[model samples]
Target: MNTEPEQVSLNDLAGLPSMATLVLTVNNRHARRILADLSAMLDAQRQVMALPDIMPVSAWLRQAGDQWSFASDNGLAAHTVDAFGALSLWRQVIIEAETDHALLDVGNAASLAQEADRLLSEWQLEVPPALQTDEYRRFMVWRKAYRQRLHDMDAEDGVLGFERVYQAIVDGKLHFDFQNLVLVGFNEYSPRLRGVIDALRAQGVAIFALQPSQVDAAQVERVQAADPDTEWRLAARWAQSCLRANPEGRYAIVAARLENDVALAHRVLREALGADGTAPAVPYNIAVARPLADWPLVRAALCWLRVLRAFLLHGRCEPSLAGAALLSGGCAAHVVEAPAGEQMWLT
Candidate 1:
């Protein structure tokens, strides 16, 4: 996904999220590659979260195999230990094995968890009481297992993987380890993706927003059919989501939709990125979209995630891993940050 040989300094205004703090990514390999490669590049004092589930820091250790790291939720390591248990060897090994076997950075809510209730409840969705207990049990098991790994790691690392990654990248927030926090799942930006973006901003971390390329041109046409105001709102919502996620960092979002109206595209994007960090903006960038005619090629992408998921459970990844790796490039992104000066170190 990182095309350039040297570090790709993404100076793109439209592609980067303005005044945001964390970059919530979905692609597994790029996330891993970025995290691992950047970990050393970042100020050691700051936190650089290596998503154990995503491409993790442990992946680089030849001798460590799948037992060197731990998986914490929301980058909060202590809570995970409290919820799961003190020593979770099985959970620790699984998280490590899954990462070693394959590198996936996305957090898919639908299939990842055994019990749907735990996730839905977190989303603030109402679940049937009858199902809550069952889901709660499943959630408890998963949470407990998840925490077991955290208890094994350095306690200060935090429980959220998103936080860990963000802490690693920011310039000013560099003091302790890049409180690399991992914001779990794309759902965070789905329906209320805008709200999610806003929320990340509130967190105050480095933001990396990604723009996805269009898998279907028809979808773009449908989007164009909506009123300009509605379109602007949608764009604004999209931008807000990224801004919120990465208040201090940069973010990348792919406007993968296709259309010829460059002017309208600009207006839509401006509305999305907003003006001041708070919100309020105009046309920002030329909303460039990526288009492909190959149906199979496109369909394969939608399924690329499954390949990563499979690799997580089993060790061998599909041949599709090559193509799946490119999805991030197909999109655009926005970034925000403080002036980078001295390397930061955490207390």
Candidate 2:
């Protein structure tokens, strides 16, 4: 409640693309040896995390009394706080398909297909282009011709089990959020994984596209065409209002809190309006409809919400941030709104 201006870092982070997860696999001959190395990781357990409402943007941020802790929503017992790195491994799968895509392999995939299953099973990996299946034949043809690559660098000790790599991510305990979800480090597997990304998006989850590190062509076209849903254009408008030096700089696709999230919607507004500034005054117009007669506290609240409108729509209601600045001086927001029958517009 201090009169100081809200720090930049204090802003809400609701929407943003998250970092990506990876899958790793090794050659078939090394499967047994790799499994032994992974045996040690099996003891590490997964802790369940809960999603909470009424909390800042994430349930993880909600503090319990004086203690910082979170409970599980899925009825899974709470264990030691999960290391973010380790948690990510569980989110993705690693498969080590043989990378050979030579033309001879393509021609022989029909004959070699039978051997794929055995080798893969021995390696504890899957031989895709399901053997004897149409996809299996198709994949064989593609592998020898249009190969789809997956990223899986060699482990320092040459031990490779996708499960072990996933466990390593969980134990890493790195910072993560949905925005950090991206598709990176995978090149050859892009085409097939493209399908996986599309499926996740259909479920309302925005994930990295098949091309990874690239923006959605559809979304970009919509924005360039100035579609209303393409709020990318609005970014510069909001940034200009906030007096940001380079509005486009904040246009990163991956961010913790973006305007799309309902939770962060009015936060900037409330902060900016309560602060003082010589901002452009609301263009005055006599409301012939309202008759200017309203209740006491109700009228006061409406006025406050209107003040909030400026900040919300424009990103900052303050006339000048460096000058008197938003939220400066001991003050509280108080204002009124027009009656329900009529809608009002700001100047």
Candidate 3:
């Protein structure tokens, strides 16, 4: 048996049987692009059949876990906790570990600790015993407590779930229905995930890595601008020119630090695209993710909630809180007109 995974180009996927499953280790956006290209290729070939199953690794793991649960008697599938649940549990453990003093930032600390724990699991590494720093000791204690909580709750996070599935596969307790498994955009894999892939290959599953097709190098242009504003404006103008040349063609403008400079990029793109101070009906799409709390509507809702909480706790709302709620445009005329002694509550 070949120990190494077989490699194939992206174009080679067109020859794959429709039953083949393509798994991607990329974000949703990149996955969508790959899916679109694959669909277009199949359409060009006039192949009218069900497309191959393409999905991200997380979704594939969930499907595999479900299959394992169905085939095996083990109840490992019942104890899986999602990312949010795992974070909440980690925060709870951190809070419980705080006996001397309160943490400066509980949320940030929890996030970091959870990431550290995940890294340890992913790399299958043992915690170092040489350097015994105060923070490290504290984290070690929190980690122990967190694992104990998971044990008591019979819960496992994503890392543990992957390991469990891997073990099941290795022990011949799990079986896959598909014959072909195509891996895409997977530059690296965790030890446990790699183990699962090896076990699948051993079971006669055809594993292939989709490589990028070789092409001539594109022309590179470097432009020095006064600042980011000028840079974005120049990019927008270039994009507009491209659109003018090929009105029906698709294009993308990539900003490396888009998340950090989303507002600036949006403003610059809108102005350059000839839609300023109005709803941007431009052909381009700007995809930037932000926390829900950063949205104005969510902020307004939170302000209203704060006002309601103050009123419930003290039997009267603070003037500052009420003013904030009113200014947020979250308060209605009925709320403003309600009598002070009416015992109002926000539903």
**Which candidate achieves the best lDDT against the true structure?**
3
lDDT of 2 at 93: 16
Q: What is the lDDT of residue 289 in candidate 3?
A: 82
> lDDT per residue, candidate 2, 50-113, as tens digits?
2111111112222221021122221112222222222222111111233442343322443344
Candidate 3 — which residues are off by over 4 angstroms?
Answer: 1-3, 20-25, 43-45, 71-79, 131-133, 213-218, 275-282, 296-347
Candidate 3 lowest-lDDT run of ten: 338-347
How do the residues 1-347 of candidate 3 rate in per-residue lDDT, one tens digit apiece? 56666898666766778675665555566578667877776565577645677788878777777777766465673477888778867877887679678778887898999898888777787656786788888888998999888888888888777767768887778887788888777778778668878888888888888885556748778899999888888988888777767778887888899998899888877777765564344566888789886687787887787677667756898687687676665456635655542444443
TM-score of each: 0.24, 0.16, 0.77
Model 1 stretches with alpha carbons more than 4 Å out = 1-24, 29-128, 133-196, 203-210, 215-347
lDDT of 1 at 49: 38
lDDT (Cα) of model 2: 0.30
Mind giving the per-residue lDDT tens digits that candidate 1 earns over 160-186? Answer: 332343333232222222222234224
> Judged by TM-score, which candidate is best?
3
Question: What's the lDDT for all of these models?
Answer: 0.40, 0.30, 0.76
